[model samples]
Target: MRNCWFATPGIARPMSIRCWSSRWRRMPMASDRKLTAFFLGFAARHKWRFLLSVLAMPIYAYLVAEAPNVMRRAIDDGIMAGDRAATIRHSLVYLGCMVGGALGLVAQHWFMQSGGIRTLTHMREAVMRHILGLGRAEYDKRPLGVYVSRSTSDVEAIGETMTAGLTNLIADTLLIVFIFVNMVAIDRKLGLMTLVIVPVVVVVVDIFRRILRPLYDRIRTVNGTLTSQINEVLGMHGVIRSFHLQGAFNRLFREDNDEYRDTNIKAVSYDAAVFSILEGLSFVAIGGVLLYIAVRATGTEKALQLGAVVAFIQWLQMLFPPLKQMGARFAILQSALAAVSKLETVMQIPLPVDEGTKSPENLNLTVRDLTFAYNKEQPVLKNVALEVPAGKSLAVVGPTGSGKSTLIRLIVRQFDLNPGGGEILLGGTDLREILREDLRKKIVLIPQEPSIFEETVRYNISLDRPEVTMERIESICRKIRAHDFIQHLPHGYDTVIAGEGANLSMGQRQLIAMARALATDAQILIFDEATANIDTETERLIQEALDYVMATRTTILIAHRLSTIRDADQILVLNHGEIMERGTHDALMTRPGLYRRMYELQRHAIPDQ
Candidate 1:
């Protein structure tokens, strides 16, 4: 029955949501749908406030619309008819209407502005939370500059413009409609004449919208580039200065700045042209109305009253600006929509890995015939098969890009392997069925680069497990040669490792990372050349500590320096993502292979082992 339900008519097959890098072509409406849903749902919740804003919009227009009517009546029955009582009574009504309209206009501005500000705050926070929700795996796929752009500029654009658009669109549209209706009611032929500029205004604005949208997108692209460049220069300030490239870098910075300026200037120039054209047409239409009124006034029997002419001019002045503002609002909407679409596209990309349903305690991992590739034609790791015997060590060795690090990642399931690529045996079961969180707790891998937050050393090592005792922390630190460094610090473990532990040496940082992994106390452990960047003395110290810490623990070691793996129970040589050779050190030396060659070359780098 369940299968039948899934197979029913009009139901789509549950295709795997492929990773962005994996797909050859882009997905359809992927980002547009997500962005539309988020924005629409948000607006829907404030529907009542929105309607209030909408209703308030035309209040100002109502005043302008009523202006001409009041003038017509004051002329026909009060002023021109030569009756003092009628003139005074009608004059008072006109004064009252002006005062009330002015006050309502002020109130209208207050509510629209308040609502825009309030909604923007909510949207900014939502974008921030969504970013924080992603795991380390998801973050690694995106560029640092792109992420920065999304948070600072992109969210701000989406939030501010969307709310501003909602407000102005409501108000401007209402004002224009009310004015058009009144103009037609008073004099249908003249009202029709007034709209001649509208089609021209709309056409000019449509061109402006199309041209300006791409510019905003380009501006954002350049913004990401500028951010990335700044980050790279700042991150590698030491290297840049050492290489004496300050002058060269400054030139590059100037070039980027100039490009950004040129792009913005061009967009502004074109938009200015659009405004100029619209403004000129508005003046022409009003001039025509004034000329026609003047000619008709000289010979007309009800020669237009003095007050009536003044109020008609005010109504004309009031009408054109809101029309102009409507165009500007449309421009903002176009630009903001472009940014939202880009941001939404990235967010819609499915996370490559998902957590397993089984409990962590009951889970283990298995890998058999495992193969994967960044590109389909050439596998980064191919037909690689291995096992982590329960409570033992398996060391992997090879040159760079030979799939050593990729092996560790695969064990953690950071990337998907082909269905028949291989099987990872966890205890007695295949890893495919194990619960992900549970599996992670059972086996944890530490990498070459040590990750530290701007936090205390104790917090870095302890992670989220608050139950770890100080004694256990001290033991791990001592074993990794990190205890001495901690003691040397001004506040010991309490000292804050700000700037991601920039104060610590590379060796000390790696030791701290090892301590973090040790704190987990998982059944299986994998170390990926953690000692590569440290000096020989520090490497030896850590190696000694690792021997003690790794005793009887199921471990996978990826070593670049052959000396570290001398005591490894089993060593596997991976070449081009395939296991080319495998055996103990003495056994592998007896055979002529990739492992033997690498061993001979590294003997100078790993003496007395």
Candidate 2:
């Protein structure tokens, strides 16, 4: 059903009522309908305010259309007849109509602005919620900057169109209609003659729009690309500075900026051309009316009155401004349509699947017949199986690209297993049957490079978990031997750390990670090379913390330093995504396997230790 709906050509995509539903579902594809149709459907959700805004337009247009007729009366009935009282009366009525029309215009602006804001706010929130629900695979496939553009720039463009562009479109259209009708009623011959220029003006405007549409789209695309590049360069500031590549990055940014500037210049040129043509056409329409009036005055049978000619001219002047503005408004509508199409493209990405129902206890970890690959061509972890009883420590040792980190990610459900690939069990319940949040609470994996936010040490350690008291945080920090360093900081536990812990040493960050792991109090802990790249003294401190953490919890350690995992209850040696050996350190050492050879080589290389 979903495929058929999206597959049908020229079909309008209906707005989903449950756009923010939590349940995982496939993202809807972009519709084939015109952009205006999609926008109208979006606005339909807030129909009452939209209708009020539309209603105000015609009311203002009616009052404006009536002003010229009142002036005709002031001239033909009062001024020419030399009746001062009648002239004043007609003049006052015209003034009242203009004042009333201005108030109606204000009301229309307010209503349209309010409606646009409400609708786009909901859209922004829904898109963000959908993004949050997506899995890690989606994030890995796209840059962070791409998502940022979708949320910020694209949304703002759509909002601007809805608030100002849409209102002007309706109001100008109605004003044109009202003026044309009044001109005909007052002077039919001149009205019909003036109507001849309408088709020519429309054709010219249409030609300009056709030229401008693709240019505007290209401009928007370039702007998004430039924004993405800027974000990427800024994020890699540390790496670029370290490698002395500042000039290279700057040159790349300049190239993108130049392209963006050129595209914008082209779009603006096209817009100005359109506006200039419309302005010239408006003056031509007025001249055509004057010529028609003069031609009628020479006719013997159907003479035009001076008052009626003046009224027709007034109506023609009023009509041309709206016509001129229509071209620009159409361009805004096109830009908004482009932005909406981009937004719909993002909305179509399916949410991550989570069908788990069972919450397990005891949390003894098991992996059976595990076979997986990030890509189909090569398997990363093949036919792997393992069992870890509660409170037992299992250490996995492997060379680079041996699927050590992949195994850890699978346990945490960062990526789902392939269909029929394998099954993971926690407390004898299938891992697929446990909610992800519940599974995470029972098992925590601390990566080698921990992420530190720009927040206080206390918040960093506990993550502001409600059940984790300040005393508990301090106790855990003390246990990990991080309390002393934290205390020595300017504000102790209250000290605000810089982003990624830039203000602290690598050892301090590792200590904080250890404290965070202990704070979770989960049944199982997996450390992926947690002590890598640290000094020997820091390694000793982390090892001590690891020993204390492993005493009562089931732990999985991926270590490059053999000494750190020598005391594990069981050790697994993996090579090329397959487990080649599994046994205790002493048992593995007695055998001529990969583990013993690697251990011997490491010990000989570092004999001083």
Candidate 3:
């Protein structure tokens, strides 16, 4: 199969050695460098273009600053001075500057937006790879929707900051500076007087930030929670409808929706107040500047020129909007930062550490004192141990909560072994010493709930592996007795499977899974109740297929049906995480132990078997 780093969400395989390499190790956490260094890395890849885009901002700002100055000259040196030709020339120059500024915007957006898209795409892929690389134990810690939000909405939030928010913020800051410089050049007294409001504007922005930061963070959190709840409910759609839980789910969604609404209202109220204050301050600065001009008119110094006064008013008009938008821009920044804070937590989740390089030559499986627990106080598997010799089959029969599935998971290294816990070995080398990719090539696990993608039957079976040809797939399917049913489908092997195989029966999914596993030609095979919840006729066909497949492979079978493992070389009865009995099936049945008792109970419960 063509192993993909970006695998289907439900389909998983062992990770490659590259997953542990320095490529991912170099990613900086938000707490360590606060996303500055991280985002800079993306820009660094296209450094020249990013730099040029930023340079365009200052040029655009300069043009904007010069436009009003051009107007000032046209009014004073042309109109007031009765020079119509000079006025027309200055007016034409103003038009050229505006046009140049417009072109600068287009160029800036093209460069900046392209880089932003590249950054967002890389971010999404990294987040998904990291999430997929996480141990099964880590998956147990959060909902699927949280990861979805991190990769989709949260990443887009950061992208918005990069493309729309950050670029404009830089332009606005530069324009503000240039406008203030022009104000001073026009008249130092009035310019310094206008500067008096700088401290006040800074104070207002600071307070607004202090109030809105937490609100933005809270909104993001609530939004993620609501998304999670919706996903959870949707996944349980069948169960919800069967149980008539519409009203209950409605109430839950309503509560979250109300909370989201309330939080947004609070943010908007404060945002509106801050924005209005900035607008009011701009007019106040203009009023204060006019008052200064009036007072100075009575002085001995030359009277303020009508053109300069008009230009000063125009500068305020240009200046205050960017300042007012500064708050809205900061709001976008806060949203992005909130997203960064959330995604950083995800990135910080340590990937499963594997430093193994060894490859096994034999498939001998061994376990000594194997123990595990999801909770510290509650051990799921106590000091249990077993072995399956090369080319031998070991059947494990146990009731629910007997650690049967956990044992299978441990064999595949789904969850990391606990410290001081027992170890597993293959070919006399510790299982941990084998590279995960190499180990995956040696083993095939068929779980009860097989993951079926929305792809053709052939693709599902071969997984696009170059070696698993069409002839081989058909041969394997025929051996497993899946070909008969598959051929009856709309397009035979080419028929597309629905999501989770809803179009196929449980038996057919298992058959396809068996075909997939056989195509791998793995040395070690594990069946974790693969035949459970299937029809008797289908179960019999699977057993026949298993009989053929298990002949030359090291096999471990966990079964609730005692009859399925009757011909196994050995059987182990496990209870409460401990093996209660171990022997050949006939030998176990001959005794009055847990194995014999369970076998008898199943024999009577399902009499046909």
Output the number of the lDDT-best candidate. Answer: 3
TM-score for candidate 1, residues paired by index: 0.78
Computed on alpha carbons, the lDDT of every model, listed in order, comes to: 0.69, 0.79, 0.81
**Tens digits of lDDT, candidate 1, 284-362:** 7678778877877786434555654555565566666656556555545655666666666556655445545654333
Superposition error at 22 for model 1 (Å)? 29
Q: What's the true lDDT of residue 450 in model 1?
A: 75
Clash tally for model 2: 0
Q: Which ten residues in a row have the lowest lDDT in candidate 2?
A: 17-26
Q: Candidate 1: global Cα-lDDT?
A: 0.69
- Considering summed lDDT, which 10 consecutive residues are worst modelled in model 1? 15-24
- Candidate 2 TM-score over all chains jointly: 0.85
Model 3 Cα shift for residue 451 (angstroms): 1.2
The parts of candidate 1 lying over 4 Å away from their true place are 1-38, 59-144, 147-152, 187-189, 197-236, 252-288, 352-355, 359-376, 379-383, 469-472, 586-597, 605-609
The C-alpha stretches of model 3 lying farther than 4 A from their native spots are 1-35, 196-233, 247-301, 334-338, 341-345, 369-383, 416-423
TM-score, every prediction: 0.78, 0.85, 0.84
How does residue 15 of candidate 2 score in lDDT? 20
Query: What would the TM-score be for candidate 3 when compared with the true structure?
Result: 0.84
